[model samples]
Target: MSIHHRIATAAAAAVAAVALVLVGAGPAVAGSPHFIKNATTASLDGTSLVVDFKEAGLESGSVETITVTAHLDATFSCVNGGNNVPSDPKKTTISDEFSNSDDFTAGKNGNVVGSLPLSPPAAASVLDCPKGQKATLISGTWSDISIEDETSGAFLAIPGSFSF
Candidate 1:
């Protein structure tokens, strides 16, 4: 091959290698959910209503399902419990406090798919939430929730939900 042809071939090969590296290092695909967030907020009014939450996010086609698990977290009480969040509300009795795990499936493009309810739980807590004078993500061991997406085979956990 001529010297010019040899130089052209070498340049093409270098470009191809650089392109491969760049693509490999780039961020995940557009459909890949950067994070799975459960914006749903749960609350209670003296054991009248049991709240629940479901993680929300854009899914990476890889994530077909996600598991929602609870954590051991807490909310602080206030001297003037008025306007207090469920963590430490003043007048009402907070009955159900549970710490358990649940699962959900991913929607199209990482959308939120399911909700894990607080009142009717898969597992019941031994302790009565309203009886206690504190905050602990309902009446259970899981103060926070965990979400494991099957697509990426990863876990994302959160405690609080959007009050919606």
Candidate 2:
């Protein structure tokens, strides 16, 4: 074979080898699990706190469960005598965790999306007020919000907290 032909053949083989290596590595990299940027979000919907999150690079067709958790800080006011009487406002800090879960199947792109709706404890239920006094929620905050993958026991996202 001519020298020029031999050199051309060697260059083609090298390029093909590199291309094969990259092709083989693609799936391994794509199959790794990760959280999509800005895809996880939290907001207050009426009396419920809604959390939405997206995870990618999961096993396709696999069943996955995500759990959302947060700590609630609530403030309440108790009034009597139809606002004719004034008293100190009561504040309650609920350190206990409130959580919700959702189940989803990973799509063909190895992505899963889910939402969790968390409801805060009622002010009347958690507060003590004298007879004829009404308990009202003044304000509340859901802090330390986080989303976890229940199937893998890994944290997918932590979008912080929201207030209402």
Candidate 3:
């Protein structure tokens, strides 16, 4: 072959090799989730907590939202006596019902867990709170995390703490 012809063939081969390597290096894509569930409740610490979920039937790129409720008011008292997590929030409107928030684009369809940070004002509301006491809303900051597929009613909540 002539000198010009040889150089042209080498350039084309190099480009093909680089493209193959890049495609193999990324994470695998998944299908949209079929089930999205999580849980939340009050923690004893009065300062922090833990939250997690299982992303089943999850797709590769769509965003998923989990809703964790942090209930408030005087009707709650973790140390003395408090109700379990609230069963009533009028109706899950993605706003008044969910007290805390987080976002995760599913990776391989599994649990996406994390620590939850919270303030008193972000505490669960029980219709009222006395001077020094607050509702049993996930204390130490806690598990008021909710995961919602909006179009679907698939979701969950749990309880935990962050007291340190």
What residue runs in model 3 are displaced by over 4 Å at the alpha carbon? 1-45, 74-98, 110-118, 122-153, 157-164
- Poorest lDDT segment (10 consecutive residues) of candidate 3: 89-98
Query: Of the candidates shown, which would achieve the greatest TM-score relative to the real structure?
Result: 2
TM-score of 3: 0.37
Whole-model lDDT, candidate 1? 0.44
RMSD of each candidate relative to the true structure: 11.3, 5.6, 10.8
How far out, in Å, is residue 56 in model 3? 2.1
- Judged by whole-model lDDT over C-alpha atoms, candidate 3 comes out at 0.44
Question: Which runs of model 2 end up more than 4 angstroms from their true locations?
Answer: 1-30, 80-85, 88-91, 157-160
Q: What are the per-residue Cα lDDT tens digits for candidate 3 across 1-164?
A: 99899888988888888989998888655544444333323344344333444556555554666554553321233322243343442211112222555666655444343344334443344324443434444322233444444532456544342343
Residue-wise lDDT of candidate 1 within 46-131, one digit each (tens)? 33223344444444443345444443323223222343445445432232334334444545544545544433322113223343
TM-score of 1: 0.33
For residue 36, give model 2's deviation from the true position in Å. Answer: 1.1
Give lDDT tens digits, candidate 2, residues 1-164. Answer: 99999999999999999999988875433365766658988889975788888888787788888888888887777777676334565545565689988788988778898778999878788778778887777678888888888785657556566777
Backbone clashes, each candidate? 25, 0, 45
Write the candidate numbers in order of decreasing TM-score: 2, 3, 1
